[model samples]
Target: MDISDCKLLKVTMDFSKLNEWRTLPCPKCEIQLDIVLACGQSFRWTQLHPGIWCGVFAKKLWLLKQNEDEVMYQVFGGKTTDSTAELIDYLQLDVNLNDLYKKWAKDDSIFSKMVDNKFHGIRVLRQDPVENLFSFICSSNNNIERISSMVEELCVHYGEQIETFGEKTFYAFPTVKALASVGVEAKLRELKFGYRAGYISRTAEYINSQEEGEKWLYNLRMEPYDIAREKLQKLTGVGAKVADCVCLMSLDKPGAIPVDTHVQQIACRDYLPSLKDKKSLTPKCYDEIATHFRNLWGEYAGWAQAVLFAAELQRPKVKNLVCLPQGRKSTKMEEIAKVSEPKTKIKRKKIK
Candidate 1:
C-alpha cells in the first residue's frame, strides 16, 4: 500500500436516487462527519475532500459526504447487505445525542460552559472490538497521525483486500488469526511498530488461542463494565486507559472513562483542583478521578468526557499567557493564541 498511489477525487458525485449514493437524514449538529471522524475515536477515515470521507469499516469501503440536513454514502466493496442499517449502527444514530448533551450540560456546570457548537457532533464510533483493541494498543505513547499510519500498515499487510477506489485500494481490518500468524511481531518491528509490535502480536495470539476466538472479545459487551475492563487488561499492552477505551468505544459501556495525562490535566485544572499537583496517575488516583466524573456526568460519563476532551484538544494554546506575571504583556503568546483559535464561530445554543 503505497501512500503515493492514493489520490483524492477532485470532482464531487451527483446524489441522484438512481446512483449508488443514498442519503440519511441527519443534521450537521447531530452527526458532524468532520468532528466525529477526525476525533481520536477511530483512525480509518481519510478526508477525500473538504467534507467527504472515505474509510474502510464493517468489511466495506465507504464513501461519505454530509450536508446541513443529511449524510450521503455509498459502499464500494463487501457482500450486498443492508448498508443503511449498517451505517445507522456504525454511527450509533439511535443514541439521541441532543438529549445526552442536554443531560450532561444540566449535570456539570463546567461541561455546560465548555459546550461550543463547533464540538457538538463529537461522538464515539461503534467500532469492531478487535479493531478497537488493536488500534488503541498502537495509541499508547503515540499521536493520532502515527496511530493512523500503524493501523493502515496493519490493514495493508494482513487484512483482506476489498476494492480500489480512485488510485487507492481498500482493505478490511485484519482478523485475530491473521494478526496471530507467526512472525507477526518481527514483521511489525520491521515496519517500525517499536515495542507495541510485541504487544499486538502477543495479544492477537492470545485472542486466537481462545476457544471462542473473536466472539470472545465481542461477548465482553454483555459483561459488566468493570469485568470487561478487567478482562481486557489481561491481554498484553492493555492498561486501564486502553481497556476503558475499548469498553467505551466498542463494548457498549458508556460509563467507561479513559484517563490519560491530558485527561488528568483537564480533571485537575477544571474539575478536581484539590489533586492538581498530582504528577503521576496511580491506580487509586485513576479510580478516584474516573469515579468523580462518573458521579458528575452519570451513566454516559464516557461520552461527556469525550466531548470535553475534544474541547481541550481544540482549545487555544495560551499557557504562557496564563503563567505570565500579573499585568505583564506577552505579545508573542497572545499572537499564537489568536492564530490557534478555531475559525468557525457558530454560537452555542443554550440547553434548557
Candidate 2:
C-alpha cells in the first residue's frame, strides 16, 4: 500500500469539536505502534494506559492508541490545522517499512533471522532535531530510565506547560534560548544530571550563538551523512554514536548506524565472529562493523540496526554466561566496576 495515498479524516461530523478524536488506518505490517514508541529511539513518550501513550511534540500534547488495524490520535492542548500532514510526517507513514525489510533481509542471513515476525512493525521515527540533540546528550553512558527522567526534568524546568491530564502534566521541550537562560548546567546538576549537565548547557549555548540556532541543526539534513555527523560531533558530549543516532533518527540519514556497546556485541557475536576474541572494540573495528551493516542493508541500515538493538535489549539477561572464557570478564563487568568506583573528587573538563 502506498502511504502517500493514506488519508486521515475526522471520525466525527464536527472537525473543529474540542477533544475530537481521529483514526488513521495503520496496518500492523507497516507500523507497529507499541514497538515504534517504546523501542528507545524516543524518550518523551509515556504509556499512560495499556495500548495508549501520551507524548509531547512541537509544543503540543497528543494521545495515541493503537489496535490491530488502526491508530487513534487526539490533540489535547493545541489545535493542528494540518493534523494529517503532521501525523504522516511524524510517523513516517509514507515509507513502506515492509518493502525495506524485505530488501534488507535478502543480503543478510543474520538480519533475516533478526527481522522475524516478532520484530515486524518497527520503524525509525523522524523527530525534531533540537529535541533529539539535547535528549541524546543526556543519553551518554546512561540507561533509558535515567535518560527519560532527565529529559522530563529539563522540560518541566524550562519548557512551557502545555496541558494537565489527571495527575500528569505535559510540557513542551524547551527552546535553546529558554534552556540557556536557566543556567542549564547548574539547574541540571541540581536535577541530578551528573557529568552530562555541562554538555547540555554548552551545546545549547553554542547552538543559541548561531544565527540559525535550531535551523542550523535542521539544515544538516541536506549534507552528506559523514559531513553531518562530523558537524554534530563539534557539539559538547556528542561522540560518533550520538551523532550517528541524530543522523539516523532526525536527519534522514538512514545509513548512519550508532554502534554502542550493545550493538558492538551483536556485531562481534553474529556478523563478525572473528571479533569475539578481541578484548575491546577499537575505533577501526567499530567503523568496520557499521560499514558491514551499511553494505548489507543499503540505505535503511540504521533501521535494521535498531531492530537488532531492540531485540538485544529485550532478551533475558543471563547472570552467568557459558560462552566466555573462564578467566575473562565481560565488558559489562568492567562497566559495573566503573560505576561502583568511589567518587573522591569532581573533575570538570573545559569545553572549548
Candidate 3:
C-alpha cells in the first residue's frame, strides 16, 4: 500500500446527529490503543474499563475503545461539530503506518527484525507543545508511573475541572498563566515533585513571560530541527534528551531521535555493534547514535526510534538475585545481597 498514492481526508461530521457510540474504520493496521497509550509518550490517559481508555485532550474529555476493525469513541464534556476529525488527527489515522513500516524496513534489515510482528500500531502522537514540554520536563530521571502521577497532580492542583464521569473527574491541563499564578514550585514540592518542582515552575514562568507566549513554543514547528531543539534547551530543566522528545512528539520534527538509555543500548547491541565495547555514552557517542538512526530511518526517524524503544521495553530481561545456602554466607554473597536490596527509603532534597 503506497500511502502517497492514497488521498488522505480528514473526517468531518455533525456529532449531534450520530449515535453515542460511533465506529471509525482502521483497515491499514489494527489501532492498538493500549500500546499507543502505554508506550511512554503521552502520560495522561487512564484505563476506565477493559479496552476502554479515557483522557482529556484539546480541553475536551473523551472515552475511546478499540476493536478488531474499528475504533469506537465519544466526546463527553465539550461540543465539537467534528469530533471525528479531531480524533482522526489526534491518532494520525490518515497517515498510513504500514507504509512507514515498509519504508523503515527497506532501509535497515536489523530494524525489520527488531520490529517484526511487534508493536504494529505504535505511532508517535502529535501532542500539544506546551503540555508535552512540561510533561517531558517532569520525565527527567523519572519512571512512567511517577511521571503520570506528577502530571495528574499538576492538573488536579492547577487545572480547570471539566466534568465528573462516575467516580473519576477530568481536568484541563493548566495554562501557563494558571500554573504560574500559583506558587508552583512550592505547591509541587508539597505534592512530592522533588527537584523537578523547580524546573516546571521556572519553565512555566519563562513561557508565560514571553511576548508570544505559547505561540513562541508552537512556532518551533516551523523552524528546523536543530534550531527548535536549541530554543527548547534554553528552558530551565530541558536538556538534549528532553528537548528532542518535545521536538519529536510536539514540534513536528519527525527526524528528531531522542537518544536515552534504552535507545543507546539498542544502538550498541543492534545497529552499531562496534559501540558495544563502550561502557558509557559520552556526548560525542550520543550524537553519533542519533545521527546514525536519523540517517538510517530518514525523515521519520523519531517514529522508528519510538517503535524500537517500545520493543526494548517489551523485551524481557533476567534480574540478578542473591540466595543463601543454609546460613552459610560468603563476602561475595553479602555484597550481592546488598545490591539486591531495593532503595525504597531514599529521600529527596526539598526545594527552598
RMSD of each: 11.3, 16.0, 16.1
Span of ten consecutive residues with least summed lDDT in model 3? 1-10
Candidate 3: residue pairs that collide: none
* Residue 340 of model 3, lDDT score: 21
Local accuracy of candidate 2 as per-residue lDDT tens digits, 1-352: 0001111111111212225346666678877766677666778775544454668886787777766766667777755566656767788777778778777777787888866787787888999988898899988766666677778888999898987764457788888888767577887888899989989988888888898876788899999998999999999999888899899999999899998888989999898998888787687888999999998888888988888886776622212112323454445322222112122221222211
lDDT score of residue 115 within candidate 2: 64
lDDT, residue 324, candidate 3 = 23
Candidate 2: worst 10 consecutive residues by lDDT? Answer: 1-10
Candidate No. with top lDDT? 1
- Candidate 3 stretches with Cα past 4 Å from truth are 1-19, 28-30, 79-81, 315-352
lDDT string, candidate 3, 1-352, tens digits: 0001111111222223223455677742635787777667787775544455667887787777766776767677665567777777777776667778888888899878887565788788888888899988888877666787788888888888886665456788888877767678988988999899999988888988999986888999999999999998899999889999999988889889988888988999988998889888788888999999988898888988988987887832212122223444344322221112122221222211
Better of 1 and 2 by lDDT: 1
Q: TM-score per candidate, in order?
A: 0.84, 0.82, 0.82
What is the lDDT for 212 in model 1?
96
**Local accuracy by lDDT, each model:** 0.78, 0.73, 0.73
Candidate 3's TM-score: 0.82
TM-score quality measure for candidate 2? 0.82
Per-structure clash totals for the candidates: 0, 0, 0
- What's the residue-level lDDT of 146 in candidate 2? 67
